[model samples]
Target: MDFKLSEEQQMLQDTAARLVRDAYGFEQRESYRRTKLGYGADFWAQLGELGLTGVPLPEAYGGFGGSGVDSMLVMTELGRGLCLEPYLQSVVYAGGLLAQLGDDAQKDRLLPAVASAQLQLAVAFEEPQSHYHLNDVQTRAEAVNGGWRLSGRKVAVIGGHSAGLVLVSARVSGGERDEDGIGLFLVDPQQAGVRRRVYPTVDGFKGCELFLDGAFVDAGSVLGEPGKAFAALRYQQGRAIAAQCAEAVGAMEATCDLTLDYLKTRKQFGVAIGSFQVLQHRMVDMRSELDQATSMAMLAACAADQPDSDERSRTLAAAKFIVTRAGRYIAEQSIQLHGGIGLTDEYAGSHYAKHLVMISHQFGDDDHHLQAYSRLMEVC
Candidate 1:
């Protein structure tokens, strides 16, 4: 397969990169970090106006009708710039799920708003003790007069506090943690008995913990077939992981860029530090690591569009595994090369380091992906 980007894709990358560098620089991010929202509403609206919030969605849904690869490009740039917006959680994760599983009525009512960024959505799937297992949901949804009532707690629901709606996954039949009995419901955040507590993350975004006493929704709110939402969730999860890997690749690239600039400026023994053979070798190694991570991210993005689930999982796990390891190494080397000042908040090097660390642990970390890859390999 051709790895080169088309003209359109290149333009998308350039637009996102420029927007991050010019409109929402590090200073803006710092200000946002101090805010209660942990992100600026204006910044998100600007991204929506630029069509970034809808790139990978369908044109019918108010999107630009781009592909997964295009979405990955935008995500990478966001990572490189250390953006505070939850574009991935709202657009790629929740929007993709709605598009794939929502019925015509559900899609017509919800997806257009999501694509236009008028209504932000988040997936409330993770439980307190589920670890990374998608099927291990204790949240329960039971049949009612005309709909379902959700009752349970969801921990670490990214962007849930600010979300207009939530795509909730719960056990509809059989026991909790059953793979075939899972269901998804579209719930309004303003509904009765719903409570959220928000917390800031190291990367400047916000996540939430939800306590649902009895959240109710119409039966039509069901996204797909009853007891079969796991397939859709898995598909969305793969896409999310792919986007995150792309982001990690972007952070790795930024780390290399920052380190190179540092090496050229700082002097030692009346000469530029970059002239030293030791630092030069380190720069060379960083370049190699970044290149490998980028290649793996590209491969994973391609695989996310494949029809086979098993193939997608294996490819994404491999990408996540490679990118996280490389990202961790690059982040460490960047700080080490820059010395003590690198840890200061004013330094660009520190931002890259923090973002890289966050990305390395998101979705699934190195160990999680390694185990997944090992399991897939055994079955294959």
Candidate 2:
């Protein structure tokens, strides 16, 4: 497979890298994180101006019609910067869902705003007990006089704190854990019975726990086919997992670069620590791990478009396992090699390390994906 970045992809990557290097340095990130929104308004506008917010959506909706790989290039740079913006929740997680499942009217109405960063969205899918189980939907949406009444709690919702819209998954029919009864609805965050308890993630990104007490939605709010949203959910999640793996690869590579630089500049025994064989060996391993992880990230993005469902699942699970494991290793080694400075709040390395580590636990952890891969392999 050709691994070289295409010209457009390279341009996207370079533009983002330059923006982060020039404007989103460690000091800027610190200030951005301290805001009530956990990010800067101007920063988000800048990203939108750069065409990143629209990269993955259709041009009909004011996007650039970029594919998964093109979006991956943008994500890699965002990860390298340890961005605090809600682009992942807004674009990858929510915008992708809208692109796939939204009706023409809905897409025409909202996707343009989304692409321009005028609106942000978060999916309220995970319940407290959901863990990584996609089928577990305790949130219930019951038919009402003219629409639906939704009630449930969604925890650790990645961008829910500041979302203009929320895509809620609720059980419209069968039992709580049944996969067939799922329905997804677009809800207004400012609705009567919706509440959000916003907080920062371990890596200083925005997160929230949302409570919906009989939140009302009209029939028009239903996205795609009712009680038939599982396929769309799975498809969006597969894309999200692939995007995250790309981010992890970028984070790990950035961490490895930082570590290698630190080793060369920081002296020990009156000489550069990089001169020592042991530290040099560790740096070598870090680089190799990063390369392996990058390959898997690319593979995952490719597999997202595979025609066969089983092939896609098996390939995704396998790629996720490799990327998560490599991410963890790269994160830990970078910190260890940097000594005390690596953990300091002011250092970029610590944030990168935290982000990479936190990513392993997102979407699905190492054990979850490993077991999934094993099961898929068994069936194959």
Candidate 3:
């Protein structure tokens, strides 16, 4: 298999890197973080103009007709910039689901809006009771005369505060955790019986807790098949995992570069700390981990497109698990190498470090993926 990126892919990567470097300075990022939106609105619009908003969608829908590799490249730059935009929520989670399962009408209506950045979306899937359980939906979607009435509470709806649309998961029948009988519906947060309490995460992102008490939706509101969305949901989640791993790799890369800069500039005992053999060795280890994470990210990008479900799961789990390990090592090492100021808000290391922490816990932690990898090994 050809491992190098195509020329088009290289241009995409370079464009992403340049945008992040030029538009996202540390002070400007702080200004954006202090806003109520918890991210930069204008910067998000700029991403749309640059065609990044539709990296993974089809060209017919105003996208660039790209795939996992393309999306991975953009996500790495986002990570390096420590971006707080809702790309993961709008593009990867909501758009991926709609593309994979939405009818032609649904795709035509929503995907174009998404690609043009006219509609912002947040996915409501996590519950207080279901920890990282993608199919463990407890929200009920009972049949009404002409549609369905949803009733359940979802906690920590990422990017909900600024979303123009929300896609929800609800159980139509079967048990709470059953993969079958699960359904996804498009709902407006302003609709009747929908209550939201928005808040900011420690990593400087906006999220919300949604209480849906009999929110009504027409039969047409269902995005995919009536009672069969689990497979599509899983597939979207695998893609998300791959994209996120790439982002973590980017953060690790930035931290490694930042730490090296610090070592070269920060002097101790009238000499550059970087000249010390022990310090140089430590930086080498950090760089090595960053390289490993990058390789794993490529593996994940490829795995997301695999035809076999088992292969996708195994490879994604392995990639996520490795990212978790490598990201933590890089973040911790960065802070230690930079001294007390590494975690201070004035410096960039703290922000990257915090983002890495958040990424580690997202979807699943190291332990979660480690167990999955072991189980896959047993099956093999």
Q: Model 2 segments beyond 4 Å from truth? A: none
Clashes of each: 0, 0, 0
- Kindly list the per-residue Cα lDDT of model 2 for residues 1-380, writing each as its tens digit: 68788898888888988988888887888999998988878989988888889988899999988877887888888888888888877898789889988999999999999999888889888889998887899999999988899999988789888889999999899988888989999989899999888888889998888898999999989998878888888888888888898888878877888888898899978999999999889888988888888888899887765553877988888888899889889888988888899899889999998888889988889899988888888887
Candidate 2 TM-score to native: 0.97
If the candidates were sorted by their lDDT against the true structure, best first, what order would they fall in? 3, 2, 1
Model 1, span 1-380: residue lDDT tens: 67888998999999998888888777888887788777778888888889899897889978988877998999998888788787989999999899999888888888878777788999998888887788998998889999989999998788887899888898998776789999998888888978888897775678998888888889898989978999889888888988988888877887798889989999989998999999999989999989899889999888887775677889999998999999989999999999998898788788788888887777878999899999999988
lDDT of every model, 2 decimals: 0.87, 0.87, 0.89
Worst 10 residues of 2 by lDDT: 302-311
Cα RMSDs of all predictions? 1.4, 1.2, 1.2
In model 1, the Cα lDDT at residue 359 comes to: 79
Give the TM-scores of the predictions, in the order they appear: 0.96, 0.97, 0.97
Q: Encode model 3's per-residue lDDT on 241-305: one tens digit a residue.
A: 99999999888988988999899999999999999999899999998888888889998998886
The local lDDT score (0 to 100) that residue 27 gets in candidate 2 is: 89
Error of 3 at 138 (Å): 1.1
